[model samples]
Target: MTDISTTSRRNFMKLAATAGGGLVLAFSWTNTLASAVMEVLDDTNLASGKIDFNSYLSISPDDVITIFSPNPELGQNIKTSFPMIVAEELDADWTKVKVVQAPLDTNKFERQVTGGSGAVPHSWERLRKAGATARQMLLEAAAKRWKVSADTLTTENGVVVHKASGRKLTYGELATEASKVPVPTDVKLKDTKDFKLIGKAIRNVDNYEMITGKPLYGLDVYRDGMLYAVIQRPKAFGMKLKSVDAAAAKAIPGVVDVVTFKNNVAVVGTSTWQVNKARKALKIDYEAEAPLESSSDHDRIFKELLSSKEATVRRKDGDVEAAFKKAAKVVTAEYQCPFLSHSPMEPMNFFADVRPDGVELIGPIQTPERARADVAKLLNIAPEKVTLELTRLGGGFGRRLYGDYVLEAAELSSIVKKPIKLVWTREDDMTGGTYRPAVRYRFEAALDAKGNMIGYKLRGAGINSGNPTREDNFPSGAVENLLIDSIEHQSPITTGAWRAPITNFLAFAEQAFLDEVAQAAKKDPVQFRLELLDKAKNAPVGAIKYDIDRMKGVINLAAEKAGWGKKEGVSQGFSVYFSHRSYVAQVADVVMKEGKPAVDRIHAAVDCGIVVNLSGAYQQVRGGVIDGLGHAIYSNLTFKDGAAEQSNFNNYRLIRMKEVPEVDVYFVNNGIDPTGLGEPALPPTGGAVANAIYKATGKRLRNQPFINQPELKTV
Candidate 1:
């Protein structure tokens, strides 16, 4: 039973005894948010009227260092990787360090978020100072005991050593005295050359516990008097609950209540199975005030919107129409993609204990502060009254970013007047739409008399998800007569942020179209991109948003590692993209297996600055690339009359283990601070696979979920 709280004071420290007779240290933070990186806390962060402190870390009498990890773990290895940053600076023996997961406490830790791959890049220097400050205090305590100058004492492997007198003391011997020393306002950090634990491979701290089923997920939370519940949402969009007949459901054993909200209904019982059964037994009716919508309807709307010339122009350089008129050749193409679901292994669930005075919400959430604020607004309660606890997620992938499920559970608890856990069944989760919006893009390019690429134009249309554009997109800031425009057609279905955000599908559309343009220019795809990137790197650009050198480095490295032109019996496809400050290039090799296009191998070159945990970075690249490949090749969602057509794994398929190709990942070496690798590797993988399929079978696929096409479906 471990819990942490925060307080602010001008230089004070307190040590208390835990239940196990171990020591717990609580201290004030002398430095403010201005001292840390500026990007950690957003403007909405409520850091007012408190002297914040480092509310983590405890030193036991036996020299066991317990450090609480600050960020939520979503299978990204932040639980193992973030603590390494601190342990490296503390000079502690890795074998003796113990890690604990910190709950959501904004007062204790600012910006306790795990999204946007910001855990390390935002908190690197701040956490280093935390460990370095504690080490300095321990050394000061040992120096006072020996009556020697503190400057003469050096620390190594959790011990403070005095070289002149040959006197040394373990951290345990100085813990009590160190608590009495004045907290230092400033501490010097160690150089990268001396780091011992950061770059090395370390096993996930929660690995053993997770494999042993030691109750790390929210589903494991239990209370003595809690009830189970299941929310029954509408089957389609623009649906309003007309009525619910719960007489049959309430007659079942263990059925406590059937609660009805403005838009949905929930069945409560003693167990999850009972509530789910009751929910299925209940008869409900809905009122529809709008026309029935389907995937075909969305497609028609997107096409109509694209045909309109009026649009919000995002970028325009030169006279695109004039360039196209004067060109020797002009080419045009269109790409379309369907809505996608995140499909995390864990279905949406939350445990909420709502009282008259406050609320306790526990779940696997990506953004705690946002959840707190949203819950407060819905319940008309104060923000501070809402307490959230973070749990190890089965998988996030941006599915947990919107905590609508959390709010639903809290509302159920409040209405039922009991602690309740709400779970969404697979069918309910599938039809309830928070999908990635479907989009369509129209592209046109022009080449000069010598077949030199000169101009570009793009028009994007989607259902409320307006458009996707990045400052460093291929040919961006490289072409003179370039123009990009987008229009939106609103839809009734719900949509939220997916992995890689808008850039996920945008990269596929842009990169695939560039390959076709290169073919028309009569040049190799890789060399054609290299020539444009050279232009973007040298002069003749508006504003460069990406490092051309880093981008080119990964592209060349991937081509070399993959042996692009040397591999025989396998057709290869190449693609590169930059996102979230990381550069990545991928090569995919394909072969016809049993008269179907099969991906044999994929090689990747990534430059995400410094690698925090070598093994974890490797895993991220592999997982992201495979996720993108699997989704682009076969994963898609369709709707009929505003309801999803697929329900579970039987209909909505994922990449199987047998289908995954051999993936090789490599990262460039550098001393720069580590950037995120969770997303950049995904954007290019889809395009690489698409281009490879084109080589294997001389057919151009302009739509996603390539397996749905007639010829490819035979496999």
Candidate 2:
């Protein structure tokens, strides 16, 4: 009965007739709070005595403040960090603040999508304004009661105090009165110096539920009488289902029904085990609909594309041909990275109940709004007829953004005329498409007599992924006569964003290539980079997309903390990158053990602007760095005749605990508005590790999954 919708501007806060007598406020972030309207649920929906306040928050008679985090939580700690933003402005006691996940209401929330590390930046001002507005209303209520000017009152931990008269009122006591006050359009925001909860380390709000085996993920969703379904999809790319025989599958013990839709077969049964067991008995035939491509074919295509002149130019500076012709030394290398799967631990699962009235969806999805729309479209129903409830995602890394699994479950439920829950086995999830495309980058840099980089040329070729080059990044503005271009080939194999996207592999290749250029010039690697940065700062160059001072800040901090070039017996490599509107610098430490180079630790320095929660921010940086390093060292996806060569973890290796290096995270807090943290820290980690390997064993890692190379071995 509680529904949130947007309307024309009226008031920022509205008094709700709640049975429990509490305040309610609602607003939107679009147009900077100028076009948003506020509403509160009536007393009929407040039978539980808890008011469904604004779209962002609800206050109770017991002094408890519940803040709704509209964005999906994918272990980025947004569920905790976002609420902290509100609590800071509300001046609420941290102990009494509660965080809840807001359901999918496109009208109520802005930018509900969770990927790209953009949640904080998108909601920072809006969330702060929400809390401040509520606090202002409370202060006005207290001032009216005391018959004093509102300016005379100050708030301390959810209490409005009039120090002149020694009179104070708790938020709970003034809640009913506050609800009657007119909404303040403009409220003063707290200065950064007064933030108590914004900088402090706060643990995840759902830690208790997550650790104690409480149901929080998509795979844990269940409903009475809901059937379990396991689908049988095409085993390889470029193939489609020609036919399917469901008789044997239906005959399996505990099997209830067998349904085929969208060229795939789904086995529905009483339990997950029954459906999974029944799926193994399905007889299906698939035929190639497109050219069956293999890893070798991609490799050949990459080489051809790099040498071909048919590439789209993204950026060009000065005359590259003239600069390279006059250079004393030319450095060239080719870097290759394979396709990768976003193998979230929970896999893909969704619960869908389709009926004539409406559709109910409950699961862990990064893009709930997109899923709602896709399901509505698939079922030929109105978008608003579908309601989605988001669960704590085990992990996304861009896999859940497509919502293919959600569509499958909705389709199955509609076909069988029953509520259904769909789950994918680990093998099915791995072999599924929408992978990080395989890419190759060919880099050539021209160095003059003084070993100063004069010209840089980069050509990137990728399968499925468009424009593999970040042309406006670090070196682009620093170097003279820089040229960047790319070529892409269409493939039946699906690919999408994986973590940091194109920058994930490109950063490593560019950084490692820079190190090689530095070595050839006989200059210190760190100094060489600093010199280029100085040139970009002082000299003439094309449009510089990255902030030079911020980039330098992280680089200086990471180098100083890691004790670069000061520790003996430990070889160090340095890498810095600017991506997703953030700058990150990482220093990797490597040592020779038993004639093999082993990564010991990583020192990461980030400048993502003002951090909301230090603890969560630190963990995010560490996790991103570790994820990047692990994938670079041990992860790669290959195909043989259109089928995935590696099905499970046994063949598709990942960095184990023993191979994981210690990560020390540091942040440069400049009080700038927050940008993104989920991806910036990851892009530079691969380059740092690659350079560290080069330092330890004098071998260049031009290929992803350094595991495949004989030069370096960690296990």
Candidate 3:
């Protein structure tokens, strides 16, 4: 874990307060309302004192800018990409802006959580408006000095320029005057075509810091007089901690204290290595629950879900059953996807300093606001007393959302009555992770006599990693007649969100099955999709959640770029999906290498509205595609008796450099609002690759980790 003493929490807070000039500029009406809402929300405890936006930014007299990002950046380029949003709008010199993790104070900073690929898109408007407003005020100050109308002065490179008088002033020169100016209520924003820095390719702002080995990650945080903690959780789900003999652990060098919490015993020591060593030295005994003692028992739950009659209907279209009866042929296929782990390169770690006044938490957590509430509730303290500090994550992949490790660290600090750091070894991280729920989907499609698609029915059972009922506001009512049903297989093992929005894997299964139906009809997959899109666009079957035109645009782009219908030698497959308000379509080119399927290239087309930071957007699309390939081909979390079966990378494989395909990403040229890129590219990759594999071998591999299935092997 990071040494917080060297980078004292108090010192970091002080620097945050004075890092930016105290000039609150209002650039647009939307910003004015958002700023007011933020201030009101910050002052008033909402959602049980969650973290809010005010905690992140502070301007100083010197005009320096400091932004406290609450989201843990796990190698997703968030540290650079998110900051770019602020710099672009704030009109601050990208070079001069300093980024730091926000201290967790649920009462002061609400909603500091970052997940669901929302960091850039959600904050885009707010951060930009904040910057633009601030710039306008500074320009006003410069205009006053030059005896020129504010309209005559403009900002460039953090300087106010008066063209007529040739007068110039740095933001620093007008900091005091700008601070006193009335925050503008109506600020004009640049059009998409006029964007100077937003659409341009820029290197990560924190790239230098990372390359130089600066203390940017959660594991690098440290504190004075802090102890290190390690917890030993149950080896199997549903297993209870029977007993533990700490004599060996206590006798270990540098071991300070040993204590048992709710489910596990923690070993505390002077250093992380010491605590880890002591944890291993300690002899632990667990009473395994019978249901969790075997892998078959866990598999039984999935089997039960597959056959269970009690299923909640997620979406329903026209008479699917009647449509099936009227069809000339009905093709039915069942696809299965296994549970997965986020397994970010950086293991889970957090530092907590529990003092009488308040609790301080530092970690790579996705939701700082959630962390604040959890810590406060667990510690029986006021939410204001708990402060969460977000740090750079090695990688999130939807793993950091749990905040369980953060809670463990706070518990340790409270027990030890001193500052402490909790570090999870790779084994601890992998085993204790909140896994992506294993899911099974059954798809049936019917075609008319003319080989024209008629009706589609999909039924599936999976653990609703999110609110499966679609009752949650974000994904609530996203699709219609979709018939996404789920059963919560209650297990002691934790589960949470993954890369794409909920049901992404299911969508892949559904869309890929649609491709199969197209093949059964001997119709072009792209044309079949366009036909469905036309129906969904003009007379949508039900809810019509997606933007049909945007979806069609991406498919057309991918098909055109991949030389659809004309490409030869390599088998081609296509899939498209929408999530986080972004639309994406992908085509995979595959070839058999040594009797093994190898993806040679992927043609990806996306319409995320407007591109903010084109290079970063491209990187995210490419990264997400690679991520999808890794998950589909290599990643799986199996269980035996309720415990995760894979322990480390040695057993649980990941896609390597050699397997990475040449990715061609093209953005649809349309002046539209910006959406998220982090996850949109991931959902379609599985189906696209699956489609290509089918073309290569004339076989449909519906199961995930496709390499493991015997059916995937060619004759």
Candidate 4:
């Protein structure tokens, strides 16, 4: 079966351009000299014979090689890894290569957006060929000047060397002639064993800049005469602005103007502080048909939805009713998790300068191409006339995918007729956040007289959140009689993808419930999961998307590393999950802290299809473990009368440094193309911690954010 995401080819290594000047290797067929050189290189006729190099690689006259990273960097280290992919094939001097964010141009690089942890996997082959194509061109150019066979010569550290003649030429010296060399439709890639910059720890391109507090982030961008702007959103969900008295807001010192748009009131000022200060004074009236709905009401609705027998069964395989009737014992459990906010480290903000001709937007946006087109359409201009550039994002975690913030800034700039930077206060972000939908899951299982599982049923309810969790996700094929059902209720609450999307909650609910099944079956949790995975691998009843063997491998590996049953004093819990095409298994060690469970250490085993950078991969796993643990322990977005109750950090609690646990990470080194590392590591962590907490206290806390129960705190 062809994988559409990977096999769909795009000419990324086409049309390169020089930033300053000289030989950026623009792969234009119109260049006669380039066409000739490419014909000579085409003697090998590699994978594909369509040479179209996107504008990414460039060489300045000073021999400075710049690689424009196509994906947005949301601190996932793509700025380092993407360049490393090219550098490995190009054999360029790593120290001399500089990486930069590419402007939003889909024509140059198809799908310049970054999400789903696909940056490396999607462009791995294209980038390697892109770099190799340039290297071969430079070698060919050097051979012409040195009067030597290109094959007889070798390249190293940005220089081509004719060892037999004791001659060498720098890439800079031959870049001019190399620019005329036609790009190979396909180029020979390096063997994995020969990779230098890849699969090795390399510092991120912006590490030094970020550590030294350099101006590289969106918030750091400054434009002269750019006014600061803040929007006052409706107080409640589905509410509309009725009226606004902006007299006091306009009278405030340094206040520029107040503009009422379709849904929001914007206060413009000389500075962010002044804008925020004046925003509070604006007497804005909001109107709704009835009282805004609250969490209390939503909870009641969700409970009813979960219990309702009328639901669309996503999948079914065998006789579920017969299996349940034949079972010796049956058990059921319920789990619920409240709404969650993205709350990225950096508050949402974007800078826009709208003009009659077009608009220029510079900010931390994950989907810049989509944002640019949306802005262009709203402004009634051609999409080509708009340019969107990326800046370093403090954190994305799926938040930057939405371009509303970008549009907000662009709309404000178009109205004010000046460059504007619209900033969302932490309060605004928390309240208006596109959150992870609150969910409720009810699971049922049947066991025979021998305690072997026979039947399975799952019914889940969520508000405005679709089944991001596929019905065939996992454990679906492991059972003989299985059925998956879901009920989704529409709501005014805005929700978007969170870390692992649906798997974030699904893993917790399913894994925890599976542990209960293990207890009833008289088996260890890890061993029980492994048993089902083995069955799924050997005798799959349906089309299972996940690799059961890979899933079992990580579970066994994590259990082995954590000494699953041998931990003397700590209560251990194990969980395994697959998401974003990667499998992760985690073992959480918990101990009684005060009257509640506290995490002591976490062991993670990941099979993310060949780790790109060991250091970066490790950090991703560790960070994901910590993040999942933190959210599982304490994180919830509540609403009262459709108004967010948790306004800021004061109420929206996050994990503190003192609460961090020692984390150990391991990777399964199967030589396959890279898969996602960011989100796959997160889902299992929640399940591991939740199960550990259950083990420590023998309390099944069905709800998320363990802090929901006051008994979790000693004070």
Q: What TM-score does model 1 achieve against the real structure? A: 0.92
lDDT of 4 at 17: 30
lDDT of 2 by residue, 1-715 (tens): 1222222112212222234677766657564334234444334444443432336566667787876677889898888987788888999878888776777877767678899888888778878887888898899899899899999999989889999989888888888788778887677899998888898889889989888888778777777778999898888898999998888888888899988777788899998899998898888999999999999999889889988989999999999999999999999999999999899898899989999999999888889998998899898999999889888898889898889999999999999999898999989989985799899999999999999999999999999889899898988788889999999999989899999989999999999999999999999888889999999999858999889999999999999999999999999999999999999999999998888888999999999999998888988898899899999988989999899988889988888888888899988979988999988999999899889888888888999989898666533
* lDDT, each prediction: 0.79, 0.85, 0.73, 0.81
Descending-lDDT candidate ranking: 2, 4, 1, 3
* Poorest 10 consecutive residues by lDDT, candidate 2: 1-10
lDDT of 4 at 203: 69
Q: After aligning candidate 4 to the native by TM-score, how far in Å is the CA of 431 from where it should be?
A: 1.0
Q: What would you estimate as the lDDT of candidate 4? A: 0.81
Query: What TM-score fits each model?
Result: 0.92, 0.95, 0.90, 0.92
Q: Write the per-residue lDDT of candidate 1 for residues 1-715, one digit (tens) a residue.
A: 2221222221111222222333234332223332321111111222232334545555655787776665778888878876677678778877777776666666767777777876777776666766777787788888899998899999888888999988888877777677667666777888787778877878888888888877777777776788999988888887778989999999999999999986888999999888888888889998885666898898789778889977888888878889999999998998888888888888888888899989988878888788888888988999899988778888878888888999899889989999888888777777784888888999999999776778999888877675655534667788888888888877778887788887888888888898899889998889889998898777565767778889899999999999987878898999999887788999999999888889999999999988888889989999999999988888989989878998887898789999999999989887778887888889998888888888888777778888887646644
Pairs with backbone N, CA or C atoms under 3 Å apart (clashes), candidate 4? 12-54, 13-52, 13-53, 13-54, 14-52, 14-53, 14-54, 15-53
Q: What is candidate 4's lDDT per residue for 1-715, written digit by digit as tens?
A: 1111111122222222333334664322122123212232121221354445444476655677777666788878778887787778888888988876666666656667678887777766666666788888888888888777889988888888998878888887887778667655656777788877777887677878778887777888787778999999998897889999999889899999999998899999999999999999999888985558799998898889987887788999899999999999898998888888888889999989999877888889888888998998889899988877778788888888999999999999999999998999999999998899998999899999888889999988988788734788789888989989998888888888888888888898898899999989988898788788878878887779888878888988999999998978799988899899899999999987666678899999999986777778888999988888888888988899889999899999889999999999989988888999888888888778878877888777677888876535432
Q: Candidate 3 overall Cα lDDT vs. reference?
A: 0.73
For candidate 1, the lDDT comes to: 0.79
Clashing pairs in 1: 29-53
The ten-residue window of minimal lDDT in model 1 covers 37-46
Model 4 misplacement above 4 A: 1-22, 26-53, 162-167, 180-182, 593-595, 710-715
Clashing pairs in 2: 25-54
